[model samples]
Target: MVRSSAPLRRLGAELRRLREATGRTQADVGEAIGRSHTTLVNWERGKNKLSKSDLVCLLAELRVPADVRKGLELLRAEAGTGTSPWAVYGLPDWLRPLISFEEDATSVTTFQPVIIPGLLQTEDYARASHATAPQLAAPDNIERWVAARMRRQQRPRNDPHFRLHAVISEAALHLYVGGVAVMAEQLRQLVKATETDNITIRVLPSSRGDHAGVANNFTVLHFANPSADPPLGYFDGPLGGHMVSDAGDVAAMVTMFDDLRAAALAESESASLLAAILEEYQ
Candidate 1:
C-alpha cells in the first residue's frame, strides 16, 4: 500500500481548513461533487490522492477566492512532485517522510536508548555515529546524512512553537560516540539545549533497569491541527524505517513516552548529569 506522505498531509490539511471555513460537512461536499463522503474523507486524510478535476470542483463548490485556489493548486502540484529540500541528500524513500513530517510538526517526542537523538547530535558526533552504520559507511553518505541531520536540528533549536522533548537512557551518555573531545562537546551541547524553553531533555537513569523504551528508539510527531494531520510514530530498522499512523499505535507510543518520562530524571537533574559527564570527558 502507498503510504501517506508529509506533502500530501499538508495539502490535505489545507483543504480541510478551507472546507471548515465554509462550514460544510464532508458529506455535503461529497454530494456536490458526485462522490461519497468516504472518498472525500480519504482525500482530506491524505490516504487517497485528490485529482485535479476533483480539486477544481471542490474549490468551485466552496467558492474559494482566486488567490486561495491558486495556492491550493500549488499545494496539489507539490503533493505530486515529491520534492523536499532534504530529498537531495539521496536518503532512502522510507527516511524522507520522517524528515518531512518533522519539519511540519508542532512538537516531537523522542526516546533514545543507545545513542544521542539525531536532533541533539553534534556534527562530529553525528559523523561518528553515521560512520558505524553499514548503510552510511561511505564517506560521502556520512557527510550527506550528517548534513541532513543537522538541518533537521534547526527546527527544534530555532522555532519556539516547535517543541522537542527527548527521553534518553543514561547509558547513551557514556556511549562515547566520537571519543573524548566530541563526546564532551556533545554533552555540553545537551546542557546548552536545556536552557531553551522549547526543548526538554530528560535522562533515564541506568538504575531504572528494564523499561518500556528498552526495545528500541522512536519518535512521535504531533501537529497543531490534529484533525487534519494526526500524530505519527517513526522508528528505524536495518534497511530503512517505517511510519506508524494508526491512532492506536501512535497512542501506544505516547503511553510509552509518558512511562519513560516518569522514569527519567527531571530536566534540571538531567542537566546536572550532563555537566558531570562532560567533566569526565574533559
Candidate 2:
C-alpha cells in the first residue's frame, strides 16, 4: 500500500495537535464521531485520510476555532489533490515517505558511513551501488532506481533555499564503487558539487574511529515550518527504511548528526583529501 503524501502527513499532525489541545483521548473523539478508535488512529497517523464530512465532524468534536478549521480545510484540499513527482518511478511503499519528506524539506543533512550519500551520488556511482544489491541487480531496476535518485538530487542542486550537508566516511573514497573510471568521475563530481554554496561535503576520517554515527547511514529532514512539521529522521535497510517520528528519537538523531559533523574534516581539508584520493585512482 502507498504511504501518505507530505500534505496528508502535515494535516494529520495538525489534527493530532488540535485533538491533544482539547484533552480528549482517541476513544472519546472516536465515540463522539461514531467511528472506531482504530479508524481515528489511522487518520491521525496519516495512514488513511478522512473524508470531508469526517473532517468536519472531527473539527466539531474538537470544537476548533473558525480560523483553525479554515486552515485544516485548506490542508485537506492539498492532501487530496495532485500526484507527487516521484510517483512515476514506481518507488517501493517504504521509500516513498522518504522522498515525500525530502521533497518538502527546506534543508537535509546526512551521515554516510559506507558510501556516498544518495543526494550527492553520480548516476554511475548510484547504478554501481544499487547493482550490488541482489534484488536491484536487474538492468531495469538499476536504471529506475538511478533515475529516481538523479531526480531527487536536483533539489539540492537547483533550489537556492534547499541546503545539503553530507558527512562521508574516509573509507568511502577508497571503496572504488564503480571501478577506476567511474569512481574517478564520481569523485570529480563530488568535488564539483562542493563548488556550490548550498552543498557542503565533509569527510569523517577513519582515524576518528568509533564515533556517534558508526552504526549506519541516516538522513534528517528539516522544514521551514518546523512547528507544524518537525524534523524527521530516516535510516535505510534491507527491506526498505524506517522513519523516526518520535520527538525523543529524532532529537537523539540530531545530536548524533552534530557529533558526526564535528568528527569530520573541515570542507577545505576534505577537498584536499578527496583530491589526494582522486590522484590514487588516476
Candidate 3:
C-alpha cells in the first residue's frame, strides 16, 4: 500500500487537534457516530482518507468550531499532495506513520510478547533480528534499517519528558537473537535502559501461561499537546501493522497494556531476572 500523502497526514493531524480540543477519545466520537475507532485512527493518521460527508459528520460530532472547521476543509482539498522521505530510506509505506507518530509522542507504552522492542535493541541484536529474515538479506539495507532504529532510540533516551513503559515476555529474554554474546549485550542493554527515570521495564513470566497481549505486540502513544493531537494505538502483526486512533480502540488497547503490565514481573524483579540471565551468558 502507498504511504499516506503529506497533505492527508496534515488533515489527520488537524483532525487530531480538533478532537483533542473537544477532549474526546476516538472511541467516544466513534460510538456516538456509529463508527469504529480504527476508522477515526486511520482518518487522523492519514492512512484512511476522509470524504466530504464523512468529514462534515465527524467535525460536527466533534463540535469543531466553525472558523477552525473551515480551515480543515481547505486542508482536505490539498490531501495527498506529497510523500515522506522515509520511503526513500527503505522503510515500508505502512510503517511510516508509526515512525512519525513516535516523533510527536510524549509517552509510549509498549507490550512485546517476543524479542526486545526496537528502540531498546543494540546494533548487533538488531542486525541479527533482521538477518534471520531471509527476505531482508541485503547487508547495506540492513545497516540502513539498523541506523534508523538507532536514530529512533535517541530522543526517547535524551528527552526528559519521553516516557517509555516496555513490557516483555520471559520467552523473549530466553530466545537468543544474536549469538550468546549479542544476546548477553542485549540483556545488559535492557537492564541499562531501566536506569533512565522516564523508562520503565517489566517482564511477563512464561509461567503466567496467557495474558491480554499474548496475541500480538501493540503500543499506545500519548501526545503531549492535547489541542494538537490525541492518544493513538498501534499494532504490529503479520499483516504489516495498523494504527488505531478511535477512542474505543485506544481505550481497549490501554486496558490491554494495563493487564499485561499487571501480569508482568515488577521492575526490580524484572531487573533481577535480567541479571540472572546475564550471568548465564557471562
Candidate 4:
C-alpha cells in the first residue's frame, strides 16, 4: 500500500467530495477504468496519486462539469504535496495515518471494550491504561504516549465542526486500573464530557452478552466531503492498528458499530450509569 502524505491526502479529499456530489461510488469509478477497488480507495485516501490519464478518466466518468474540471486538474497536479509532524514525534509508523485521518475528520465514533477511549481518558487514566505494559512504564515513553494522546485530543475540543460518538463497554467501569480513586476521577471527567454538544458517550451493559464488539475496539471517522475523502474505519492489529477503506471492510466495521450501539445505553442513560459507578468509588 502506498503511504499517505499531506498533499495527496488533500487531493484525495477533493476527489472524494466531487465524486460523492455526483453519487458515484469508488467501485463505480474504479471499475470503469479496470482499476481495483483497493487502488481507488488508496487514491481517494491520498495514499496513491492517480496519473493524468486516470484522473481524466475519473473526471469524465463522474461527468464533472467543464467549469469544474479546470480546478480539479489543478488539484490533481498538486496532490503529491505536504508533510506531517507524525514523523517528528516519532510515533509508531502504523499510527501516523490514523492520526492524520482523525485530525481531518468531521466526526468520529469509537467502541472500546476494556478501557476509556484515549480521546476521552483523563491523564492519570490514560497512564494507568498503559501502565500495565512494562514496555510503556518508563517515564519518558509514558510521557511521549501521553503527550501524543493529548495532542490527538485537541481536535474535538478546538474544532467546532468536529464531533465524537463513543460507545464504551460496562466491563471497563469495573476495572480497578490505577485503583478506585483513579477510576472515580476518571468517571467524574466522563460526566463533564456530556456538557459538550459535539461529544456523545454510550455505555454497553454487561447484560448484553456476546456482541459483535466482543472482538476488539474500532473507530470510524466520517468526512464532510464524501468525494474528496470518504469515511474510514480503523481496528487494532498485531503491531498497532490497521486502516480499513475497502467498502466491504468499512461496511463490516459500521455494522459492528450498529450492533454495539443497539446494546448500549443512550447518552443520558449512560451518564446516569456513570454517576452510579462513581458513587461506588467514593
**Model 3 misplacement above 4 A:** 1-10, 13-44, 47-88, 136-140
lDDT of residue 186 for candidate 4: 92
**Structural RMSD, model 1:** 6.8
Q: lDDT tens digits, residues 1-282, model 2? A: 233356777888888889998888999999999999988876786656778899999999899999989999888877754455666777777787688778778999999888999998889999889888857456676788799999998898889999999999998888978799998998888888878999999999999989888878898999888887788899996677888888889899899989899889999999898888888888
lDDT of 3 by residue, 43-152 (tens): 87777677788889998998888998898887787653345545556876677778877876889999888889998899999989889874644766888788788888
lDDT of 1 by residue, 47-114 (tens): 45688899999999989899999988877776654334665787766777687678779999999999
**Which pairs of residues collide in candidate 3?**
26-247, 27-246, 27-247, 27-248, 37-246, 41-245
What is the Å distance of residue 118 in model 3 from its true position? 0.5
Q: How many angstroms is residue 204 displaced in model 2 relative to the true structure, after the best TM-score fit? A: 0.5
Residue 21, candidate 2: alpha-carbon lDDT: 88
Stretches off by above 4 angstroms in model 4 are 1-7, 10-83, 136-139
lDDT tens readout by residue for model 4, 176-276: 98998899999998888877888999999999988888879999988877665667888874457788877778878888898889889988999999999
| For model 4, the run of ten residues with the poorest summed lDDT | 79-88
Model 3 has an lDDT value of 0.83
lDDT of each: 0.85, 0.85, 0.83, 0.81
Model 4 quality (TM-score): 0.75
